[model samples]
Target: MKKVALLVIVTFSVITTYGSIKSYNNLNISSGTMIAILIMIISLSIFLTLIIDRKTLKKRYIEKENELKHLNTELEETNIELESSYKKIEKLNSSILKILELSSFFSAPKLMERDFEKKVLDLALEIIEPAENGAIYLFDENNNAKMVFAKGYDYEKINELNLKKNDLIIPEKAEIIKDIHKINKNKMSPKKFAAFIKLGGNLKETLITPISFNNELFGIITLDIENNSPLKNYEDYHTKIMDYFGKTFAGFLKMLNFIKQEGKFHKDIALTLVKTLEYYDNYTRGHSERVANWASLIAEKMNLDKRKIEQIYWAGILHDIGKIFVPQSILNKAGKLSPEEFEKIKLHPTKGEELLKKVDGMEEISKIIRHHHERYDGKGYPDGLRGKNIPIESRILAVVDSFDAMISERPYKRSLTKDEAIYQLKRMTMKQFDGEVVRTFIDIIDNFNIK
Candidate 1:
């Protein structure tokens, strides 16, 4: 509008100047009139230049505004991508932590075969989501499916179903069974398949995977979602995770079997030493076994872990192993031992430790054996370890070993009755034995006949 108005004013001024020049020529106009006309023209030219400059500045401002909007959009997109990446990193960290937790499960000590299988099933369930039920099945020599571990269902009922390897229509890889009844009856046993359908009303989706390594199937792990429709609840990664767990568990089982075989051999060697002690002194017959049984019972009553209880039991078996070095005359002596003979008896704990430390994996057992005679008040020999300084396994053994010896007949002394043995145990608390261990030992005596 300003440019158009300036153009109009300039046009009118030009026409007016033309008319004024004519008048000046005809009438001989004054010099002031010419100067006034020149001033008007100069003023219009200045106004037009200012308007053009303002238009250029306005255009630049609009361009700059558009550039800023584009930059803001790009920044917003980058923020979204960054937020997504951060979430992925957090999820990856969680998965890694779960994997580390699962990796450490097998290393835990003293789990029986069934306990180990149950642990595997539990850890698998933890990693996968929305799974309320799981079971682990092993293939027996007859190619029969034996339910070793079951969760979220009637365990006894499932085990009684008598599932066979040939009865299953599973592929080599892990799979999600969306509908159990949809499976072709011609490919699977109708009798067993119908049994699963009738066994649990809540069984909906089943993720069945083989526990295999090198294409050799050792077992099967099955996870279930209860009381839900057969929707696409699992992804490809779920099956992959199941497969990984199956293979890992298979490897663990193989290693466990090998370890069990090795453990049997080591046990046989330990038993041989026990038999040697028995042959040396007829009075000590069955003494070591009885002590082991009592120590294990006391350990169980104390709520010790499986690993520690096993160690205590082995320590009990080998507690008298060092006494093999003692002279037969000193062992069966009906009379009281001389001071020199007593010193020889005290050396047995140290001797037991020295002998067993040479064997692999017996390091912990040796430590327990070496300190079993150490009294709570430091009055006992072999280390004089006082108060809580003794290993817990040794403290447990101290109570059990003394009680068994008190109740068992020996050449040097008559066996005390059960009540008398219990009295002696209570009397010696905090002095000759750990009070907690003594109490734990006596509390469990009613479960077994001491003699």
Candidate 2:
């Protein structure tokens, strides 16, 4: 820009000097007019140079403004990305915390516990509108939305007040349609026996998010506010976010339930195996039931924890599974077994353990079966350890097993009287049964229903 200005100035100066000399020496025009003409030409050159400089200045100003605007746009975009990333980190941290909470109830949350639905609904409330009211409804086979979990305001409270679990006509705002996220609660909607949830008010804002997995609708969740609620508006983005999370949670629920279903399926298989015992020997079948039931009563009477009681119950039922491996001839033998046959009968416990160890989640049950025959005084077999060396469940099982065998009729003799069976158990307590377990068994047997 400076170089162009300088060149114009030098050329105009040279022309003015030459024109002055011409008028003074040889030209016909007056020196004054020639001077005016030279001045005018110089003025015109100065004006044109000023114009070019102004154009260059204007161009630079416009270019600078454009560059600043571009930078501003980039900054805005970067801010958006940073905000998005921060939210993702926060959400991930929250999910990890929730998973940790779930781990307390389930070793691995393969099935969704009831609290999971509430947690998800809480998140939905936070994302869209944090109302105190919310609920999760699962679709039954008939496609009716059945309320499984309820929050601030739901059918549960009605039943808590001695009302029906649900009103005959549920409020429109409380109901949810399958496969859509929507909200249309208003003053015009009618009210009903409204579960005493909101103190007393009408629906303010309601949002329902459908939980879908693999393009199939699983359930819906609804959150609403009472009249005079805080929020006045809802946004589309909130629905999108709720829908996305709803879908994610639904998939987790489905996957976990599958694990539960599989576990139940395994239990059915175990029971079927038990049924095979009945086919071969009704005495053993009936004996197994009585023992299982009586063992559960003893465990409960002993004030054992829930898990221990459950262990004893399942262990008692499956204890005789090893007997399946014993030859049917020996299992149903009408007379006392020969020594060789007795040894073969003793093998049943080990056989049961070996077969059942292959089943998932039944390791403890198998071990209990293996040790159920172990005597409290260390005379038991398969792996005889001393008193208190046997698994507690097995010790409990020994007393229950003996009591049931005595009270139940066998092919060899008529069953003992209940009182007589009690006397035998008490007589054998220290040597054949764990003393404490026997006492607990005695204490609870009368309360137990045998039939």
Error of 2 at 356 (Å): 2.5
Q: Which ten residues in a row have the lowest lDDT in candidate 2?
A: 179-188
Question: Quick one: best TM-score, which candidate?
Answer: 1
The regions of model 1 sitting more than 4 angstroms off are 1-89, 113-119, 130-133, 150-155, 169-186, 198-208, 213-216, 224-232, 418-428, 442-451
Candidate 2: TM-score? 0.62
lDDT of each: 0.80, 0.70
Question: What is the clash count for each candidate, in the order shown?
Answer: 0, 2
Per residue, candidate 1 scores C-alpha lDDT tens digits across 25-92 of 86777678877876778676777768786897899889998999999999999999999777656655
User: Which lDDT tens digits does candidate 2 get at residues 1-451?
Assistant: 5747676676868686766678677556777977787777777777777877898889999999999999999999999999987876666566555534544534333233446666666656665544557777776556555566777654554334432222222332223332121122221123323334343246665666767678766676766665565555444444555555666666766766677787689779878988988887667767777788888878887788666777678788788888878889888887888999999989988998998889887888899999999998889988887798898889988888888888777787788887898889888888888999987877776686653
Q: What clash pairs does model 2 have?
A: 110-256, 111-256
Error of 1 at 286 (Å): 2.1
Model 2: residue 403 alpha-carbon error in angstroms:
0.9
Error of 2 at 204 (Å): 4.5
Model 2 C-alpha lDDT versus the unseen true structure: 0.70
> How high is the lDDT of residue 158 in model 1?
68
